[model samples]
Target: MTALPRRGFLTLAGALALGVTGCQLSDPRITGGPTAPPPRPTPTPVPDIPGLEAALRHESDLAALGKQALAAADRLQLGAGQRAALGWMSRDHGVHLTALLAPHPAERPTSPPTPGPRFTPRPEPTSSATLAAAARDGAIRDLTGRLDAALVDYRASARGSRGQMALLWGSLAAYARAAQVALVRDAPRPDPLVVPVRELEPWSDAEAEQQVLRQMHALVYGYQAAIPWFRRPESQTAYDLLVHWRDLRDRVTRLLRDRGQTAPAAEAAYALPVQPTDRNTAAELLWRMEAAFIPFAGAWLAAATEDESRRMAAEALEEAARLCLEWGGPMTTWPGWPG
Candidate 1:
């Protein structure tokens, strides 16, 4: 290299400094890459079931009925608490309708069902009629009927659906079942089953079955540990729950054997988040164990294939949610899919 003059040397140094400082060291963008905003992601298409539109319509109608009942409750001066009780259906049914309409939002009716212009209440002469029994054109009865009908639609929709759709309908059915139980304490409870028709993730039916079986075993064990620690009534409740879980475990075991899958052996004891030192602690432990089923049952519902199995799973999920309340868990909008 030849020696350069002072001006040339200064210019060359300046050029080098510019090259070093002015250029970005960042990774170069690909020829047609992230420079332009990524094409707006196309939303994944939701699955459409055969009877889903009907389910959506039913939810709309159910929501309307709930609104009317709420209005009637307000008209009768049923108090803030009673008004709140009547309001859940109005809110919950909106969620039900949205889930049903997810596959094709356009199918939503232009004019959704509406509560009529005015509310009418027929208070009994005895002044003893509970809000539940009030006859506003048998509005309470109609509300009950709508919930029952929605359950029917949810079940039918689950049958026609697969994967996530099945799970969605099954969850809705379970929640409806819970609402029915809440309304009428004598509503039929869920029983064990051979299997059901769907699951959200594409897992083996046997795999899901085994999971619930193992969890049920642990729950039964947990209930047994807690029963002795609870107070009189709660102790009885705990005992009853233990019995149910024990029986469910046996049923699950038999099902697994019938399917030729090796049933998992229960541990001598389970490690739990809560320890049963006293009544409150025991109850808390038991509550958590039961609450675990809400989500677990939803996962199982995703894989259930037969109608009976689906019903069993759905009801199990609902039962778990109800039990959580009994065990002093706070109210949650969505139990299985908890926030």
Candidate 2:
């Protein structure tokens, strides 16, 4: 077919007729109020994972028991270290179960689909960071009894590999017992600088900023139980690498006090803030810590032979610091803003 000239092929301009237009009567149905009644609830898909649920339940129960023990110790004013240990144990186990169960497909259906970003306020300076604190405390109150019992039993024992291991475990456990008492009487709080603003709730605007400080104190001190293990194996580099972790911990604790002094709350509260500028700093610090841990951990692992598992413990300690620094630090400034 012959093609039309360029001018002749010009497109037609569409026009709306305003003055003269044909109209037809229309019928419309109007609905009132809201929509239909809510539908029946769906059968929750409880994941039948082998032992997962049981473990979660068991840990939860243990944590509850630990909390009770902690409370009892507080009432009796005894075994502070045991109470603290119990508190730590409780919080750790609870956190562990929370993480394990958080990913189950069955769990997803029961909980509402997370529509948008869910913010968690950094923990606040409270009576204790964990139920393990209580357990630790309880253990301490009865330490005299425990130590007396251990000493009585130890005099009759002979030395062996198992004995050495038991001795080490016993010494460490005793140290932990001592620590629980100290922590309970004078619990170290978290730093305020690191506390997120979201943690403060039901507080007036003027007092909310103080919540941030309270949260920092609670969080930094929360890592107290685990952080010191890195230095015990006699490694300066390991300790140096942990400087960031230690600094962050100290910083949070300091911040909490500073902020609290500036803004005191009627009661202790935590608030994780979502400030873009602050988040950026937190993200950068986390990245730095992660980058440092890889090399530090390698150094510890390379020297793992012939020595007591001190090297292994050092490696583990480094890993723990790294993880807390990475996941527990400001998470808002990530791949993208959370919904």
What TM-score does model 1 achieve against the real structure?
Answer: 0.62
What are the candidates' C-alpha RMSDs? Answer: 19.9, 24.9
What is the model-wide C-alpha lDDT for candidate 2?
Answer: 0.32
Worst 10 residues of 2 by lDDT: 330-339
**Tens-digit lDDT track for model 2 on 1-339?**
222111011111111222444555675666897788778677455433333333344435544545665666656464544454555544533443343344442111122222223322222223432334334435444433432333333222211112122222222222222323333343332211211111102333223223322332433332332333334442343344346445543543444465454533222422222211343434333333332222222222222232333333233333433342332321110100001
Q: Which stretches of candidate 1 lie over 4 Å from their true place?
A: 1-48, 68-88, 104-142, 181-202, 229-234, 276-283, 306-311, 330-339
Residue 29 shift from truth in candidate 2, angstroms = 22
Error of 2 at 204 (Å): 45
Residue range 190-231, candidate 1, lDDT tens digits: 221112122134457778777777778778877888888878
What is candidate 2's CA lDDT for residue 141?
45
